[model samples]
Target: MPQATFQVDQEIYREKISTAIIRHNYPFMFVEHEGIRDLHSFLNPTVKPITRNTAKSDVLKLYKRERDKLKHVIESIPSRICLTSDLWSSIATDGYLALTAHYVDENWILQKKILSFHHMPPPHSGPILVEKRHLSLTDTLFCGGEFFHVRCGAHILNLIVQAGLKVIDEAVNKIRESVKYVRVSEGRKIKFAECIAQLSLSCSKKVCQDVPTRWNYTYLMIDGALMYRRAFDQLQLIDVHFKTCPSDDEWVKVENIAKFLKPFYDITTLFSGFHYPTANLYFHGVWKIQMLIKEEIRNSCDAISSMAKQMKEKFDKYWECYSVVLSFAIILDPRYKLQFVEFCFKKLYPATYVDRVKFIRDKLYMLFEEYMCLSSISTSNQSSVACASGGDNIGDEMDEFDIYESQHYGLTRNKSQLDLFLEEQKFDRKQDLDILTYWKANKLRYLELALMARDILSIPITTVASESAFSIGSQILNKYRSSIVPKNAEALLCTRDWLYEKGNIKFSNEDEEDEELAEDFESIITTLKNSSNDSHSSFS
Candidate 1:
């Protein structure tokens, strides 16, 4: 095709190209490829295809623009933000912390933003990590972070499951060995398949090995091996070398353990979701996990009983006494108010159920008072206050909806909103309730307690959001792109997320970039390496 005289805006087109490179996680030099350059030239004879340096500059510019835009959105938010953190190491022996923020905006929609991909050196201890972030963002944290340090539900479940899995170690080893043997050679695989065919085994599953560290994969390995037991038994009779097949008794033990792990696997998948699962939604998942552990603790099988005890210790260490924040999250759910809270605690700690429930109730009331004080100052200008008392709008749309004064809302001035919330009958649990929508629709009703719900609901159930941010690490920090400066690298990763927020990029696992570390920030801060304090880089 002949070249055409295309009068394209040079800088504008360069930015579009730069956005594509970062959004798709392409290397800056991708634009420098001969084919890319030639294609641009053919399409626009007046076009100036960017060199690698130009691509880098354009990416940084885009990053700064988006960072400022997100910063303003964050600063203007009326409710507190929840955060999740992840620390990562690069091939260059560099450390980066990825910070992500989850919050309900003024419009009452849940939002997640990557605030920073900061560079930090080694010695990433608990205190050091805390201090590094507080150096700049301590003020933005909720209530001085007394309720911060929310553990990832999925990670704790993994730990508990791994501890319990110790009882099945012997059975798992035998299955692992048999799978390795079958997979070691093509001949062995074919022989195993023949054994399945000849034995007329109904199982469609092929035996596979697990990574050992991951309990879910281990569950799959054992689950599949148990199904193909007939084939393994047949192989043992036919092949002299297939001596590692699990015994019938061992298979029976494996089956019991798989049953024990099935609920945990389900919960992990639930909590690890990127978009949907919230802290409020996790009460049932965690309650079911606690019950399952208690159920197995009394099992007739010694191995299963012993495994449950081991897991109980881990669970007690992390969850039994440490789920105050999570409990608060569940209490905020309109479907399960104080009654469900009492029910959950009564089931777990029967003897002290009353006291435990009292403790949570008192703490919630105290937290609500703090929010009440904060809201008094922030709500002075709220036009909703005018509309509630049958007054005119203060330069905004207003409505006289006095539910509090009406008997329908059970309005009482002596009782606080938290008390009133507890007294009201729980919303129908069977009904579909978008909790955010519920709170937003009733914002004029409960007022400050509704603000607390905004933050509590935004609390992440898992670190999966931050972890998913690293899914693109393999594509970004490869040998070819490893030399990209830390400043540019942070810019690229931050912009991909910023682009996703703007509807310019799809936030799919198939394409993304990995930055250094994790954790959410109050603002969209893509902090640069402390060593290179470039002024134009706004988030730093």
Candidate 2:
């Protein structure tokens, strides 16, 4: 007998190597790592470690395999999907565009996928972005027509609040500068810590720096600094160099501004949720924002009123273009539907309430009719098959009559799906009531109407999902890893998300070990500090 030779499994080997590259955001040259080569050598003496070029090829192959799997999933699904896209500039001054798709699968689970994350060369104008998207999505199974483009609601809220923030820029600058002054050096940090200890303040949270691009960071910085007000006061008394301490009136203004901005912050956070449907929740938030603006505009304080005026201008500028799709989305929610929309819109736009309500109702009906036509064609084809099979031709004819009656009466006499859904008692369960669950349960009952709901409900209220992809891109393509070609970076970023979604990846035990080490180090430092204090007391 010939001696049997042991052969390495190329597929498994390639998978293990690809996993390393994705999990750690490793460079393609990672195969050249001494430990990696040695481990491969130990596993298979006959197999050679892959070179950088070969590793890159394997990574691309893995990416294509994963991309094909996702494409199959998107194609297999029968519902429309919503897309959110955003442009980001990397540390290397490279501009990249990210597109994410949102949908509710048949299991009633909310699903988000990063459809594309790739470089968008210079002159990133609107038309250029649109053209880039058309190209990127061309090969994917998803049809562009089925997708509705939604601007990120959180980003829009940021813009609105930033407009209001401009009203108190000088005050915010002072607070920010004061925070930077305290955090700039170790001596200042020590001095500030001493002041906190002396004041006996319960807060252990340190002052934080604010990034100008994110208004919420400013909120957090001011909120944190306000907690150490007395400490700062103490610092001002002893430190001659503490020139940036906010004055009493400035502190008061900061407090008022924070208070005024709290609702916007809360709404932004609420809308940024990834695990649930936000479309149905948008109307209530927008209504609350409108009410808040009105209330603030009539405030007794001149400063707040002026700020509200600026915010209101920005809010109207964007929201006036609020797509009818948003209204349709809310109407599909059984809990709200057309009645709730009418009531809210009447209160919101009292002057043009009649016209707006009529417009929404008409648009919703038109949408329903469109879906009904599609359902009719599908039902007719199935019925024709049943008739040909000789199961029950008479029954099939009767079923057609029922569908015709439903459509004719439902449309001409206000007995349609919209009316039926609206007239039925609204779903009373509010807490943890899954909107997708309700739709799934009632899909058969409403038939074509349910199909329409699924498509519209899948539409996200914001582009935050795409913005989050940019965040991941930033981490993957940081300054230290600037040499990562855009193609590899895209593969790494998207694969990471796909693997996470599929539950094929998890945080390593090393993270837990590091956390434990940190805790142990902190405890040791505390012990040393107590020992030093005790020694000083004994000496005294």
Top candidate on lDDT is: 1
lDDT of 2 by residue, 1-540 (tens): 333268877777777888888867787787888998877777677656788888788878888889999999999887877777778899998999998888777786667899889898888777654444554466442233323345567777888888888888888888787787876776776677667766777554446677677787778777877887887889999999888889998889888888988888888778875454447778777778877987899888777888899889988988754567777777777777777777877877889888888887887777777778777887998878877777677888888988898777765444777678878887763756677778899888888887777877777887766776766676788888887888988988888888764421123442453343221212333455687899999999
Q: Which stretches of candidate 1 lie over 4 Å from their true place?
A: 132-144, 190-208, 379-411, 501-540
Which has the greatest TM-score? Answer: 2
Runs of candidate 2 exceeding 4 Å displacement: 1-10, 39-47, 130-148, 204-206, 274-277, 384-414, 480-483, 501-540
| Residue 518 lDDT, candidate 1, scale 0-100 | 13
For model 2, what is the alpha-carbon lDDT of residue 23? 67
Q: RMSD of model 1, in Å?
A: 12.9
